[model samples]
Target: MATKPRMHLALDFSWTQVETDWRQPTSWVNRFYPDIGLFEDVARICERGLFDLIFFGDSTGIPNTWEGRIDAAVRRGVAWPRMDMSPWITAMSRVTSHVGFGLTYASTFMHPYYTARLLNALDHVTNGRIAFNVITSQRKADFQNYGYDELVEHGERYDRMEEFVDVCKKLWASVDPDAFVWDPVSGIVADPAKVRPINHVGRFFKVKGPLSVPPSPQGRPVLVQAGGSPRGVRASARFVDHVFGAGKGLALMAEQRVKLDEALRAEGRDPQQVGILWATKVIVAETEAEALRLKERLIADVPMEAVGAWLSHNTGFDMSTLPPRFSLRALNQRIVAANASPVGFVGLLAEQYGEDMEISRDEFFRHGLHAATGYASTKAGTPVQIADYLEEMFEATGSRGGFMLGHSQAGHRAVLQNITTMLVPALQRRGRMRTAYEGRTLRENLAAS
Candidate 1:
């Protein structure tokens, strides 16, 4: 059986417009801090779509890589004023039963014990309806915020993350699930004998004892990772339950799946164990022509400066500093050499234009600048047309993990509303999506497809 495909809402990217456009009447994010209204409504919408989970990919600091300045990022809301998503996950879980929540946390700077305790408590709070999107932080400002002089090299960070996750796992297992036996007759709460110290001494992290919190309903938070580099793929194969992917289209995603499966087999693990959910942007409407028109409108609204800022932030290169003659392929080479962060879709640009093909400055601007317009892997169609595209991708990639859609126009609410009310029902009618969740815990629900 083709594991009934799974779907999740990529909140971080989708919610980007909220801050800039929040004052607009259609904006979902009414305010910045304590986004109670925004989150609750999003949770209900995702739940109605029968989404397996709603996830946020977060960062810790204000990015300043663009033009060697933080002004653009801060002003444009390019991942600035970042809020800790942990609190919102708990709040969302309160209103929904089965839709899971995944929160990103960097393994680079955080102590293993703290990570273990925090997520364990959340797992309990959500009744195991939680996943941790483990990320290896590479942003220089993020490192500086944590009292580090510089960010570690990419490979070394993942190495440390491996040990970080190891220590956390041991701490989570420090207290046995069956150890807690509430016996009012003898006034005993837990079996002390069953609890033992992990005493994990690792290369990157050292933890002394058992976690104070008891075991969560799902034992441990599901591990979600998004690492595209070779070392990253290997690390994910060893530990991750879900791997987030980004590509330009279904063909590229299928290619990535092949690579991920190879990594899993190399690690002596079954390829089926890890789900590959490609990060995608989707636009849907009552008709295909209307969706195309919406895409065009969205493209026109995107500020090119925001694109440059985002690219600079991600690649650690000031777009303005580069020579005017620089080609997109050249930029990719520079990023690959720096190992600053995942090159992501930019790396795949070479596939479209042959390696030797030169994408001129204007050509590069035409494609790269509109990334914020939400067109990468973007499908524009009616409900059935969108459903058909999703089904085709599922069949092509053999994606047991399914898709993570980040609606670029999420602030409009209409896009999200159409998805839950129109696209989802279309999928269900075709038996491509679930009518209801099959499991109680997020882990179980995830295991379903």
Candidate 2:
């Protein structure tokens, strides 16, 4: 008999209950935002479930796009108060042996050498279980923090990103893996022949010389990128080992896979070797009713101001300036003109609801409520039911990649517990999930999948 098809699983703690869920009675984040123990517990649980990686998405600025002020975002805690999380990942690594960690950085603003060196060190600390998620920041708030007065042109941002990765890759390869030889007899630490200067001078950055660190396990960190637009897809194909896909719907997901495959082939890379981890939101319970009940809390008591703040920050267009009624096409054109992400929330909206369709402000907020809270895409059900949905999606989307399951209600510890203890066992019984970690490093385990 043919071996049963299996899928990889990752838990996304990027937002980490910063959504309205933090206000719920079941959430503990209100009392413990930076508590190391909180993340350590999560690490242990995920390891027990045999998760491949725990991902953290990041932004360096507070939301000030809504109504031209940061008060609303700060007051509601929407995408604000984010910690660096590198140290947190280090702390979690100490407790788990098999799981990997994915850390995000913005290529649009950060220097390539700094990022490359930092990830190399993290790979050493995690014993080779590290993945680098590089992004091109589109939010105005992020640009301001980087000393930019306005957003970079959409295509130019990707241009910079490509060059950024090129520089990083060159730096990573500067020092050969076998360079280190701690020969005490000769008082020699490394061979000069194996180390050389990269001397890279690109349009975005200039860096000189060999990285001042030993070669890390896996040689380099597994590279991950999330770019859903055509330009973004091309950039991802050029370098990314895997993709962080937006889970809009089955059809869109399949279409994205095909586009990525085409782009990969254009770059002379095989599509089969690279996977797309769809960003999925799920709420699992013993019964469907219980899961649905928890899902309802996502929209509970969330004011319009908070929704506006989130939408504006992500799309880089102030929702407060939206006309009483407008078409998605018009709004998207405006956002693109402003040099924001052309394929963010507005792009998703156009794909879902026709671009020419006009929507009233109130109706838009209703949709925004679901989008901002992640309720529109969240799947809630029992372990068996959720697994079935996942199985269908995994197969429909070419069965190459897997799901990066993000928590719908961030602070609901019980929800995460159910995923590891209940849902993972269900998938394991069906031979759809890994029963044991098969590789020492993250790249190897992803290859095993």
Q: Model 1 off-target regions past 4 Å?
A: 1-15, 18-25, 30-34
- Judged by whole-model lDDT over C-alpha atoms, candidate 2 comes out at 0.91
lDDT of each: 0.75, 0.91
What's the alpha carbon RMSD for model 2?
0.9
Backbone clash tally (model 2):
1
TM-score per candidate: 0.93, 0.99
Clashes of each: 0, 1
Clashing pairs in 1: none
lDDT for each residue of candidate 1 in 107-173, tens digit (9 for 90 to 100): 9988888888999999989888888889898676677789977567888899998999888888888
What's the true lDDT of residue 90 in model 2?
Answer: 93
**For model 2, the run of ten residues with the poorest summed lDDT:** 406-415
Task: Quantify how close model 1 is to the true structure by its C-alpha RMSD in Å.
Answer: 2.4
